[model samples]
Target: MGILLRHIFILIIIGCSLSVTVIKTGWSEDLLFFTEQYPPYNFTGPNGKVSGISTEIVQEIMKRTGFAYRLKLTPWKRAYELTLSQKNTCLFTTGRTTERENLFKWITPLTENPIVLFARPTSTIKIMQLSDLSEYRIGGYLGDAAVDYLVTRNIPVETVRDDKLNVRKLQGGRIDLWVTGEMAGQALADKTGHDIKKIFTLTAIAGGIACNLHLSNLITTRLQQELNTLYQEGFIDRIYQKYNPDLPVPVYKTK
Candidate 1:
């Protein structure tokens, strides 16, 4: 009986020690990084590996921080939900909005995207302001920030699970306007061979890594600082230029 009690005590000590080690490591086992298939930002490459501008930047950050992570490409809605519910989970290319300000710990801005209203070349719609879009049939992607923005303003939006479908909807005259990132829309149009044109720029968004609120402030601060350094040292510019050589790099400001 004495020997069995001693062994049980030893096991308890070992378990406690492992718990402390995990706590000190910040991420449990490995960090969970989630993203969707947004081309030019993050998408599966020809080799089946996740590759894109934002993916490269995130890879560099992980390399610099010496952190082990598991990257998964999932639906944006599932990724967003996991980031909100799980600890030490992160979702990338998330737009920073006033409504979402306190929901997650924002690490760093990965890209600056102009949210625009797109219409078919032959469409006769014109959007001078937010209110002007109310009359038109607006198509938005599910779990996108643009949809929430429109909904909050009392504008009716037709949401689909896949953003690519919006392009088809607009082309077929199913929806009058498509709200999405300008570059994202262009990339989709290029892929589908559609001639979608930007109708108006709704707003410019700084999208970045949004970690679960349970994430340690220390880890978030460290990442933010490292990303700022990368931007200032022009490493971010180099990565962006590699993917978009024809376009001028936008200046990144750390907030």
Candidate 2:
């Protein structure tokens, strides 16, 4: 009877140790990050590595947290859907919209993403409000919060696969205005050598990291705390300065 009891005790101890190891692995497994080719935020550089404003910020956060991770640059729609469906995955430089507020655990306010309307430099279109442009044709891209915002307001907007196409459409007079994030539009325009001017600032939303719903809150909470520390330490500011020294650094908002 004493020998039998000792074997049972050993089994219970081994089971408990295995359970703890499983829990630790679940929390510390390498994270996968997804992002789109929205330049100046997250994009593939000429060297073919992902590097940009939000990309750098996220890299710093991961480094400080000592989390093993891999980042991929893909189409916006693909990245959005993959992040939505996968566990232990995250999407960054995502706009924090009401429609997406509860979809994922968030680490936010990485950058200011002011939705704006860009028109050809010679164009005379004016927009005082979103409704003011009802008479004019508008263009937006897929997987962008601005597209959803327009559709929600019952606004008619032609859709494209990418924002760069909208820049081309605006240049070709196919669309009167291109609605997109301010910095992204500027970067695209500059890259394509097309001069576009911002005609209206529709609304400002913060860009953030959106982790999968099943992602452990423990990881999210730890990352959020590290992000806040980065902001407080002006590390985020220095990153923005490296990208665009003229643009004002976005203020961090804790949730």
Candidate 3:
């Protein structure tokens, strides 16, 4: 009886060790994802799962490269933290910025998005340079990079919880300019009854899929290489066209 009991205990230990090994290997684990709506990028579908350009790219990366992952859409700040905190975690369509460079291992050149400054039709503000933004009050997404750039350079600005509110405030004559992603701005302007027009194209911002720094470089490079191959084959463009019919997909190259 004692011998049988000891053998059973050994079997349980062996089984538990294999389970831990499999989970750690990412072969038997459901990986975690972090994202926010940067649109035509990541967002929640009507069925409450992930759906967007970022989601599409990530799905292909997982399928083609055999990485297992699942996505969760949350606000940007929390998504950023969650992605940075977990193993086998990633955030998508995220702007590859100097501020966040060290926080994640990158799979970059995902998409090129234009960040622009917008103004109401009634306003005739012309922006020739970033410095010109200081002339009037500006509004944008609370944690948006443009606002961060301006504020870091000592340019005074206002932040709204989201871009929709910025349009409303602009329409209400509360702000002279708003910074936003061009694709999103155009779509949003068309959707909402706002007479927002681009003051100037700020710059072409590069966004990508990134994993927490704790994730192995092997995993990061695997996805990056697969995406590069997809880009060369024009598959990324095929996915982008699904989100916005008129959008012109940019060519990807590694620096």
Q: Please report the candidate that would top lDDT against the real structure.
A: 2
Candidate 3 to truth, TM:
0.83
Candidate 1, residue 47: Cα displacement in angstroms equals: 1.0
> Candidate 1 has what TM-score?
0.88
Q: Residue by residue across 1-255, what tens digits does model 1's lDDT show? A: 999999999999999999888767775458889999888889889999999888888888888987778899999998999999998799988988888889999976788878889999987787788888767899999989878778877888999999999999999999999999888888998999999888899887788899999988767887888888888999988998889875435567656
lDDT, residue 244, model 1: 89
lDDT of 2 at 172: 97
Per-model TM-score on C-alpha atoms: 0.88, 0.91, 0.83
**Lowest-scoring 10 consecutive residues by lDDT in candidate 2?**
246-255
Worst 10 residues of 1 by lDDT: 246-255
1-255: candidate 3 lDDT, tens digit per residue:
999999999999999999788655754566677777666677666897778887887888788977677777777767777788888788877777787788788887777788888888767788898777767888878766666666767887788766778888888888888887887777677768767788798777788887888776667778888888888887888887777767657667664
RMSD of each candidate relative to the true structure? 5.4, 2.6, 5.8
Error of 2 at 150 (Å): 1.4
The lDDT for every candidate, in the order shown, is 0.87, 0.89, 0.77
Residue clash pairs of candidate 2: none
